[model samples]
Target chain A: MQLVTPGIGLLFWMTITFSIVLFLLSKFAWKPILNSIKEREDSINGALSAAEDARKAMDALKSDNQKLLNEARAERDRMLKEASEMKDQIIAKATKDAKEVGDKLITSAKDAIEKEKLNAINELKTQVAVLSVDMAEKILRKKMEDRTQQEAFVNDNLKSITLN
Target chain B: MFSNKYKITKYLIPAFLVVLYVTYAGLKLANAQHEVHTDSTAIVTGTETGATTHSEVSHEESATEHKPEKVDAGKLIMEHIGDSYDWHIVTIGHTHVSIPLPLIIKDDKGLHVFLSNKFHHGHEAYEGYELKEGKLINLSGADFLDLSITKNVFAMFVAVIVLLIIMLSIAGSYKSNALKAPKGIQAFVEPLIIFIRDEVAKPSIGKQYNRFMPFLLTIFFFIFINNIFGLIPLFPGGANVTGNIAVTMVLAAFTFVITMINGNKNYWSHIFMPPGVPGWLLPLMIPIEIIGVLNKPIVLTIRLFANITAGHIIILGFFSLIFIFAEMNTGLGFGVSAFSVAFTTFMSFLELLVAFLQAYVFTLLSAIYFGSAVEEHHHEEHH
Candidate 1:
């Protein structure tokens, strides 16, 4: 019977003790404990979202760098092509100028050689006429040592001239 | 994992053998006790029905003759589980060593306060109140209120103090390390708090669980701590605080009051009108609902009280077996004691599990009741 009985004294004490426990714990213990838990959860979420944003920003920056590199490469390729074209054009112009100068030199040298050849031919003709006259004079003086032979020679030449 | 299972079975085989051995020994002892118990029951029944004429004459005469040898197992079990004014520690020969507690009573004459030790172990009367069969009886047949610090109440004070210290420290740690990873006792206690929150409070009571968390946690740790302390079997441990019917009644009352106070309009309507039921059935349903409402808290009270008390009785019963057999013969007593001690140890372990389990069950059921009380009706009929 005692085992099943509910003692009034115990019930009274239990009510008082349990009420105090509930009141104190609710004010001091549960309030701080639960608040800290919620705060920790919020911080964790903030850190995760921040990490996600950083990763996205890195991806965007990586794409931007790739675009800049591609543009630089294209510019380099155009500059290289223009430099090669200019080199080819300069080489062709130099070669053509050199050929024209060589042709002018050859023509001028050919003209000087023709003028010298004509001058030399005129001089040679004049010298050959002077020598023929001196030779004729010398042959006449030698024939006049005999006066009669000289007179007959002159008359024969005159007669041949009158007949012509 | 397979290796681990095999290892577990390796250890399990020996433990299983031990259990089998203990059970066999227990059955043998039971058979022996049963034989002696029949004769004793006849004498005990005779004493119980002294007013009746039939078998009392013969049995009463036999009971008086056999009183020296007979062991009262029922009395021993009751004394252990029942509340007392003094804390019994040990017994040596003819002397009982115990810690006397305070006794306060208010009678017709005036208030009387004294130490329980003045009773001289219930052999004498002190201050007009005689300690009779573990109860204080007024000498002049006057009505008085006993507000003594009985064993259960003292144990509750100890339990409350321990609860306060541990809980306050945990709260302090939370304040110092807010939003930081838990450390020390915080690490150990945090998970249990979260488990009650997620598994018990949230699922059972839903969103309004926050409002009830303080009360829920207080009762959970209060009962759990007291239950654990009750298992200690020493000073500060042996008081069956949670097993006391009065204590459990108060705890259940708290839940009942909370539920009634928090019950919403929908809760009341469902009990009074009971949606989806035919109008003719209203008469039967409403009374049933009212009975069901009252039954919930009563069930909670009995469930906790019975579990804790039953555990104490089983342990005490196994312990009482040695004395029961000893009263028969010395050698039989020695032989029975080995099995008695072994079974008592096993029961103690089982009680430890029961201690936590009962606390959890009480809290969970309370949360479920709260959930039902505050639940909203989203499917109301247009009519």
Candidate 2:
């Protein structure tokens, strides 16, 4: 009979004691503990998402760096190509100008030499005519001192001219 | 991995083993009973003559003769499972060592409080009150309230203090190191709390689990600790706190109160109107539904009380076998003790599993009831 029976005293004690325990625990223990767990979970999630954002930023930065490096390399290649082409054009233009100047000088010098040769030929012809006249005059004056000889010379010159 | 056939065999083998064990125990108990009957008759005859010659014999002689009296297995087991006014630790030779608890009672004279040792372990009365079969009775036969903190109640206090220490410390750690990982007792207890939350509360009580978490956790750990403590045969642990119907009744009552308080209109509607039921069956259905509501907590109370008490009884039963055999024949007692101790040890280990399992079941069921109470209903058209 005692085994199955319930005592009021224990029940009263249990109600009061358990209620106190539940109240104290809920206030001091459970609320704080549950809050901290939630806090830790939120913080962990925050950290994970932050790390993800950082990784994404790093990826973006890396891609931007790669794009910048490619652009720089392309710019360098374009500048180098342009500079080389300009250098070849400059050298070719300078060589063509130098050849034209040398041709002009040689042609002008030839024209001047031709003109001097013609002049010298003309001068020698005139000097030859003058010298021939003087020699003829001296020969005539010496011959004419003897009348007969002079006449003979003139008659001979005329006969020779008629024969020619 | 158990294939279909193997699974069948698995269950079948255990069932067969249980049948075999029960049959064997029945035979042994029957034989032991026959022997006990003869032995009790002899004791009764001997005591009758001894009582007649009591005038010449000293009181000490009578006490010594009554000391090693016949061992009644049922009484022994019941005593082990039942509550007591004192915490009985052990008995050696003719001496008994136990811790007396405070006795508080209420009567016409008002509330009276004193040490239970005043009764001298049921030997004599004190201040008009005498201990009778573990209850304090007034000699005047007046109605009184036995509100004394008995063995079970004292054990509960011990359990409460232990729970406070463990939980407060864990709570303190959460406060001090809010961001750090759980360690020590926190680590050990956190998983169990999480299990009750995720496995028991969340799934059963759904989104409103937070409202019931404190109560659920309190009862879970409280019952679990008491159950484990009940298994230990030592001073701090021997009190059958959880096995007591009064404790389980209070626990089940709490669940009942919370359930009824939290029960929504839908819950009541389902009980009274009961959707899809024929109109003619209203009266029958309503009473049954009300009974159903009351039955849930009643079942909860009895289930926990019986399971724990039964486990204690089985183990004690095994222990009594040796004593029963020894009273029949000394050599036979020695031989039976080997088997008795083995079975008792095995049962104790099984009880360890049952302790945790019963706690889980109780919490789970309470959460389920809470879930049902607050569950939402949806109307659907059926063609």
Candidate 3:
């Protein structure tokens, strides 16, 4: 093994130089680096804030959608209730109109029947009267055929009137 | 004039040397434009043995000179440290150990290697290996400044440059498009950057994360490079710099200093006289807190050093089985060597993940300490 050793001068110079170099590096190079790091942290904070806002927006939207859904269900229920009421009213009115029409038809038919019966009775009476007159005429004609009858008939009639 | 002199003393030669080191190392093998195999770091151990011809036995009573009996290749191979397979593997008989390239430094004159007679195996009495070729023998009398053109030094240089290029590229991408989707190398780098910035820096230092980014990044990148460089197979970029205690110590020291400097009044007060506590308990708590502060960096240092060193030693130990089993018999050698290749390959893959992990851990610790230092306990203010 070679027992060659480094002299003291090299060590002395190296130690001295290394110390100074470190000092210069500390002074000149450290500040810029730290600034950049701080900038990055600020950017990360911005991203986190943006994410939180998005979550709130989504929650609000979900509640609004629920509210709209509830309102739509209420409106549908109201419309069905109104339509049911309208159907009942329409049925009641129609039933009243049908009953009125039936009553009017019955009344008009009764009146017509009564008129027809009266007319028929009048016609029958006239006929009966005509026939009775005719029959009496006939009877008188038969009696007047005897010559003596004409004088007697005139006498009877004069006496009866004087007595009355 | 004296203040100005103090400023000069603080910066002048030191800055110049850093620039010089970077340039000198970069010029060696910097794939700045297209950094492919330019690992962050690598560790290559050398098995340089004293020649069998003249391993002279001399008893020169100096730290530099002691001699041993002529060691044959078989014994030398068994003891050989650095890049060999044995250092990566530890078995029942042998433990993994790395022989560092004799540390070298360069100047106007040629290269040199330090002469140390300190027997690595023994603290007692022994001889040391000397260079065979006199002309090739580059020795500086100073213990540390052995300027030799060794494989490990060149690797260290190359690895550092490779790391710089990768980091610079990542920095550029960040500057150009911080917000856009990362593609190419940007994809690989951006996650690490953000993790460090958001998880490590911001939470730790509160309002002061911006002030500590560069220091954190440099340490992370430096550790990463050295760790990656240590894993490569070849010599030029294969020295485990992070595994070395000396290297880890310097990094930990930086963390300690930064924490101390940046700590506000609240931090110091909390450590010394914790709020709402009994007056009598202050004495016990204060010393413990001080020790605790010191211990943080020590842990950081040891963690990196131990992890990096262990990976290399494990790889070496597995590799040494080939030689050990080879001595057993031909059939055993072939069978053991075959299995070893498979095992080593599996481990090497794990090392890639580990390289990045170690870097991450070091950076994380530093950031945490910085965080505590600048932490303003709001309750204390209310009191």
Candidate with more favorable, higher TM-score: 2 or 3: 2
Candidate 2 structure quality by residue, lDDT tens digits, B1-383: 55975876677657656655664455455444544554543443443353333322323343367554667898888877887788888888758898989888889999889998888889999878998877678999999988888888899999899988889999999998888899999999888988998899999988999999999888898899999999988888977888888899999999999999999998999899899988899989999999999999999999999999989888888889987765544444566676677577768989999999999999999999999999887666341
Per-candidate iRMS values, in order, are 0.9, 1.1, 4.8
lDDT of 3: 0.62
Tens digits of per-residue lDDT, candidate 1, A1-164, equal 67778998888888988899999988988888878877888899998889999999998898888888988898999889999888888888888888888888888888888878777777777777777777777776777779788789888888889964
Residue-level lDDT for B138 in candidate 2: 92
Candidate 1 stretches with Cα past 4 Å from truth are A63-164, B1-70, B329-331
CAPRI band for model 1? medium
TM-score ranking, best first: 1, 2, 3
DockQ values per model: 0.58, 0.46, 0.09
lDDT of 3 by residue, B1-383 (tens): 89986885587557645644553343232222213342432221321121111111111121134223322434433232222211222223334243333434344453534422222323222122233321122234332233442333334456656655565555466567565456687577657777888888888777778778888877886788778888875544456556666567778888999899998998899898788778999999899989998999899978997788778777776777765544323334455665577577878989888999999989988999999999877884445
lDDT of 1 at B252: 94
- Point out where model 3 deviates above 4 Å: A1-91, A94-164, B1-160, B174-178, B197-214, B275-277, B317-343, B378-383
For model 2, the docking class works out as acceptable
Q: What interface-residue Cα RMSD does candidate 2 give after superposition?
A: 1.1
